[model samples]
Target: MTYQRLAYDDAATPEQMHADCRVVTALLRPAPSIRFEDYPREVVKPTLEISEAAARLATALHLHLD
Candidate 1:
């Protein structure tokens, strides 16, 4: 028996790439100062769409680097 490999293509426009960067950055953000009062300004959180896009981008990166 032979194993089949998954193949995928990851390409995006400049705007889309920016959005994806935001998503991954948001996801990887360090825990803020552990305080209820001293909090950072609120910002729109990244969406599920961006998370998925970032995941796809990471997979593509790993595959390409291999």
Candidate 2:
């Protein structure tokens, strides 16, 4: 038996890339010195989206995920 490698292309417009960057940065920023039991719910979608985008970009750039 032989195995064939799958291929994928990851490309994004400059505007989209910038937007993703901003989203990730905002999520990673230090939180305010306030009491909070949980993170904001609104940021969940953007945070996941940015994470996926970054993973794809890293793969496209031939970066090792490990």
Candidate 3:
């Protein structure tokens, strides 16, 4: 599959995409700081929409590169 197609394909159901997005969001989140108070402020926060797009792009790149 082409990169664009792989990244934006409609083959994946909404549930699957949401799950993938959640995984990507978790992976992209910053590690907690040693100080509990600073942890929340320092951590990166990614929206679900952004996570979904990112997950799709990453998958596309990986498959294309292989």
The TM-score that candidate 3 achieves is 0.29
Q: Return whichever of 2 and 3 wins on TM-score.
A: 2
**In model 2, what is the error at residue 26, expressed in angstroms?**
0.3
> What is the C-alpha local distance difference test score of each model?
0.75, 0.76, 0.71
lDDT of 1 by residue, 3-38 (tens): 876596657899999999999998996776888578
Give TM-scores for every candidate, taking all chains together and pairing residue i with residue i: 0.30, 0.32, 0.29
Cα lDDT tens digits for candidate 2, 1-66: 998765965688999999999999988968575655565445544333347778899999999665
User: Which candidate do you rate higher for TM-score, 1 or 2?
Assistant: 2
Candidate 1, superposed: residue stretches over 4 Å from native = 1-10, 31-66
Candidate 3 lDDT (Cα, 0 to 1): 0.71
Which run of 10 residues does model 3 get worst, by summed lDDT? Answer: 1-10
| Lowest-sum lDDT 10-residue window in model 1 | 46-55
